[model samples]
Target chain A: MLTIKNLHASIGGKEILKGIDLSIPAGQVHAIMGPNGSGKSTLSYILSDRAGYDVTEGSVTFKGRDLLSLNTEERAAAGVFLAMQYPVEIPGVSNMVFLKTALNAIRASRGQSPLDAMQTLKLLRGKASAIGLSEDMLKRAVNVGFSGGEKKRNEILQMAVLEPSLCILDETDSGLDIDALKIVADGVNALRSPERSMLVITHYQRLLDYIKPDAVHVLAYGKIRRSGGAELAHELEEKGYTDFVNEAA
Target chain B: MTLAAFITRSRREQEDWKYTDLEALLASTNKTFNLDTGFRRYDEDGDNRAYLLFLNGVWQSARSRFGSVPSCILMGDLESGYQLTLGEQTCLVAQPIEMVFETDSNAPAEIALKLSIDIGKNGRLTLLENHLPSNTITTIETDITLQSRAKFVHGKILASGTHLALHEVRVASGGYYNNFSLLRGGHPARNEINVTLEGEEAQAALNGIMLLRGSDHADTTTRITHQAPNCASRQVYKTVLDGKARGVFQGKITVAPHAQKSDGYQMSRALLLSDQAEMDARPELEIYADDVKCSHGSAIGALDEDAMFYLRARGLNETQARALLIESFVAETLDNVQVEAWRDIFRREIGEWAQ
Candidate 1:
């Protein structure tokens, strides 16, 4: 349900993503694997409407609507979610209040009635317990003093609460341990459905082992050098990106 | 001296007052020049049982629950104001007591009131003042004394007006003095607090917040002295400035030579919401004691861009995200308020200002 054609993105006159194109249908998971400086994160950030980047030439559409034109908040309202590589730590606003504000804003944009305080609390409690976030954790300032695993889980909690159609997991497995990886994977797996799609961006295949992707695109030197089925991830893992990175360069 | 004479004589070019323009403030207060027609309105203090009301510098006993004045307590009208005195070892904590003052907006005259409180040895008293923003020029000097082993908790909410509020407190041995104020800027307002710990084991905490916007100006100046051994003092002042608002904080802590083991700490932080918003902070520490711990810190900054982006990406608009960040920036300063009701009042006021 997402399309990208000849997307050339740059930050500060330095080209990061050059002539990249991809498409993902609904109910599918795609893993974008690339070594360092391969424009994997640049793609995710450009899709999520992050500032400070200029898309010199390209077109990106989500569900038949131009995604590049929408602001970050509008993109979020349009069912685009990005679980950032490093979740921001916001002191003073409780996690519960942040989630509630986000949910209500999205709902208001879609002509839905906002949930009352009690209703929001109930919904949060059920969702939090399912992903193993405690009531006390939800009461604290967002991500302040949280460990890496807890930050990822908190992101997952927001994803579940927001329930965006296009979820971009940007290096969600980088800082997580084995058990923490399982927990985050379970959370992502629980949200997988015919109507939801996830772009699991990572450097290693360890995460794809947990949340299996339907397609694997090997990105190197700002281009999608190869696109294949799930086994492509195994080949890249066995023989490191020694050839793809140099070959594409 | 006339208020005009005092304003003209004050050295606005001095190092401490360099950031604020007093001449401009004085010119803006042309309407409040009335010294003759004064105190024209009365404010309903809701339930007399909850507070002692002073409307336009006049005490309304009918609007005060202390019609049945407690034992060991004496209160009556002064020549132009009111006075309350508590006997030795008296306790005023059985009921929540708030002393509220509201100015007469119609007249907007120059009003000055003196609040003198004396807590005897082992006595306890808690007081709260929630004064609304005013149109008049007002001066309130709260002079308080705590005898040995006495305890006093004082909270204040000061807002817009050409106002000057001074809190002078003296704590004897083993006494506790806690003061917290939340202030919003007027054309020009100042809250100067001077606290002295005169005896051993005395403690004082001076914490306040200044939420200034527009061209409003507020100054928070404090001088805390530790004269006796084992005495401790803390000062935390936070300022949030928007528009061309100017906020100043000068916190000075002094430790005497004989006051060994004196502990003094001061921290000042300011958040500037616009390019024109300005903050001036100075932390002065004078230490003569060899065995003392005294430290100070100051930080002034604008809103966090990364945090703002994070909130906006989560679907909150610019206003909602800004309010959340500003609220958290000043929430820690309110923690020094020991009373929850007073804390809630400050919170409600801050929420309204954020909106």
Candidate 2:
């Protein structure tokens, strides 16, 4: 469902990702584990077409289309979703309004009719309750005064509502407690299916306990240093990325 | 001497008139417009509330559905304007009261209207002032005396096509005054309000929103004086400027020595959508009381780029994302309006402008 061929990206004249090569077929979940500044998040941002990231070389293709050619909103409408590490707080736009607008925009791009307010609210309530978000929280401003766990869960709610084919989770486990981690993992686990693909980016192996990845790749020095089975995550958690960083250097 | 002549001879370079060119504005004011008694345009009061309708500086009609006559002309100025009074000693069960002034002229004239209101002890009143004009200049002054425990709310809406507008307000002893304004700028406009807390335990709040586009210019100036003990005041102003529009906010709060327990806060925020749009904010606090709490802050910037990107990543187009942020920025000030009907009308106008 997604392909990257030596994707070299940079920002502000400094290169971040150097020769990143990975491909995730439909129905498979891939994990990218790396240390700080190892280009794991950079890869996710580049795939989502975030501004300020210049692609100096290579290319990214999603579902047989040139993903890099689309803008940020277009990329989102084409079924590419990136769950950010730190969700931005929009002080006055309610969470419910944000979700409805996003859902309708994506649907419109795919030739679907817009949903009425009642229909949108009904769908949102059903999906929100499953993730432990109350109706009041949905009515509040997006991520305003929300706890760290609530923000992460809101990101997952967006992912579920949009139902993107390709999901990119960037450090979703960084600020979550054990209970929050379980809830977020459970939300992700329920959305796994044969036609959808996920690229989970993290530095820790704790999240893998609930939502296991099909394959694990160790990223260092802007490149994938190792690719192995699910055990690779556990091995790295026990050994850390020190040896991998030194080897890549 | 008439007030206009006295104002013309006043020093133009004083601290209060530094940002505003008052001399030039007065020099250009020559023509005078008579009151239009033709009620064909504003015959309907829009809502079923007691209202006072004024067209081109003349009182057209006054209707009361709840309380006695809201306005009584105590006296008249020598050259122009009237000293009208409003409200009495008791709270009225009537609907919201509206004072609407409208003009549809492109002539170079100055329309001056003065109002003096005395709210009796423990009385309550809600007044909504609507300014709907077409390329006209206006100067308005209102003096208010509130007895102990009295409450007053002043809501004003400045719609499009107004050339210039100036307003001054003064509040007295043990009174609570709340003033809210929503201004849409299609031409140059100005609003200057001065409030003095003369009695102990008096409270005042000033909040306004300015929406400007094209070459529109609008200025809002407020000076609040806390003279008695235990008084509090708050001022918040928000502006959204697009195109090559310009906005100015000059707010000052002063606390006297007798007002030792006073609390004052002032905040001015502006959102500049286009690179050429401009916003100038001057916030001042002069305090003689050592035991007072006073703070002022100003913020001016474009929409947060990261926030914009986040919204776009969620599938909103650039215009849609920008409109949402701008509306929210302006709505923060509108949320403080206490009247439901006024709030609804302001919301509708904001929605139309965003579109």
Candidate 3:
């Protein structure tokens, strides 16, 4: 469902992502484990086409389409979802309204009729109930004064409501308690289907415990040095990234 | 010399009124066209309160609400324009009184209106005014008086025009006065508010929102005075400018020597949607009392790029994201509207402006 080939990206003329390659087929979940500054966040941002990032070289493809050429909104319409580590706190725009607007925009891009207010609320309620999000929270401004757990749950709620084809979880496990981790993981688990794919990006294996991945890749110094099964996460937690760091060298 | 001209040659031009060239504005608009309009017309199917309509400063009694209107509230037409006096035990809680004004013809002309409102002790009232877009030089002067323990809420919606609104207000002890204006740009429009807290324990709130684009111009100037002890006032104004449009805000506060324990706060924020857009803010505070507390804040900025990217990544296009963020910025001021239902009116207008 997603492919990154020889991915070399940088910001402000400083190279962060060295030449790298990774792939996740449909129906499978892949986890990228790396220490700080491994270009893990860079890869996720490049996939979503955030500004200020210069793609020095390499190409990224999503479902046979050249993802590098698509802008942020276009990539969103194409079902590229990135659960940001720090979701932007937007004042005045209610969480419910933002979700509805996003849902309708993606739907409109696909030539689907927009849902009315009632239908939109109903659909949001169905998805929100699963995450234990209250109606009041949805009515509040997007992520304004939200706790870390609440913000992550809000991201998962968006992922569930938008139902993007390829979900990129960029450090979704950071700042989450054990309970929040389980809730977010449950939200992700419920959406796992044969037609959907996920790339779980994390620094620890605890997140992988709930949303277990089909494969694990060790990323360090802007390159992926190892790829193995779920057991690789447990191994990294125990042995640390020392071996992976040496391999990159 | 005209008032606008005298201000044009002020010696203190550098300190205040530097950004807005009102003299040139009034000079730019001298020709006036006659509207040739008369009394008002309105439908009263669902609304129970009196509907007062005015065309080109003339009251239209034929089309306005009469049978349902309470006789005790209206003070009849006067040489100083219209008047409303609410005595004690009076309350318009059922619905806000609606006043509509329009021009008879589509002609650029100078229209002046005057209104005076007096609330007796402990009286409560909410007044709403709506003006249609008349591309002309229009001006209105309002005088407000609040008695002890009285509460008065004034909300206004203005359309595009060279509109100038001058408001003079006074609040007695235990009285509260709220003024909110939502302006839809202008060809150099301005609002000047003068408020005086006369007795102890008086309060006032002044808030407004301005949306401009395509070379439109707007200005909000205010002066507040605390005459007695334990008085307070607050001001919140937000403006959004796009294209080459410009917005200005000047807020001044004064605490008299005898006015101890006074509290005054002012917050002004503006959003420049494009590099060509501009916003100017000036806050002035003069304190004679040592026990008074007064502060003012102003902020002008463009839309947050990070917020923009976040919205787009969620599937909104550039236009949608920009509009949403702008709406959010102004919502801070909109939330301060005392009447909850009136908030929807502002929201609907904001949505239309966005479109």
Q: How do all the candidates rank in terms of lDDT, highest first?
A: 3, 1, 2
lDDT of 2 by residue, A9-128 (tens): 998889998898899999999999999999988898898778898899998899999999999999999999999999999987799989998999999999999999999999999999
lDDT per residue for candidate 3 within A33-144, as digits (tens), equals 9999888998888888889888999988899999999999999999999999999999999998899999999999999999999999999998899889998889999999
Candidate 2 lDDT by residue in tens digits, B250-296: 99999998799999999999999999998999999999999999999
For model 1, which pairs clash?
Answer: none
Give per-residue CA lDDT, model 1, range A173-204, as digits (tens): 99899999999999999999999998999999
Q: Report lDDT (Cα) of residue A65, candidate 1.
A: 99
Q: Model 2: runs farther than 4 Å from truth? A: B1-14, B22-52, B62-84, B92-94, B105-110, B162-168
Candidate 3 chain B lowest-lDDT run of ten? B33-42
DockQ of each: 0.68, 0.65, 0.85
Using lDDT as the yardstick, the better of models 2 and 3 is 3
- Per-model interface RMSD values are 1.1, 0.9, 0.6
Question: Could you tell me which 10 consecutive residues in candidate 2 chain B have the lowest summed lDDT?
Answer: B34-43
DockQ of 2: 0.65
TM-score result, candidate 3: 0.93
lDDT of 3 by residue, B1-355 (tens): 2244335444456455577777676566543323333212223245455667776656667756744457445555524578888878677756687777777664335666778888999999888887766655667778899999899999888877677777899999999999999888776777888999999999999999999998788888899999999999999999999998889999999999999999999999998888999898989999999998899999988789989999999999999998899889988888899887789778878887886
Instruction: Give stretches of model 3 more than 4 Å off.
Output: B1-16, B27-50, B66-68, B71-80, B106-108
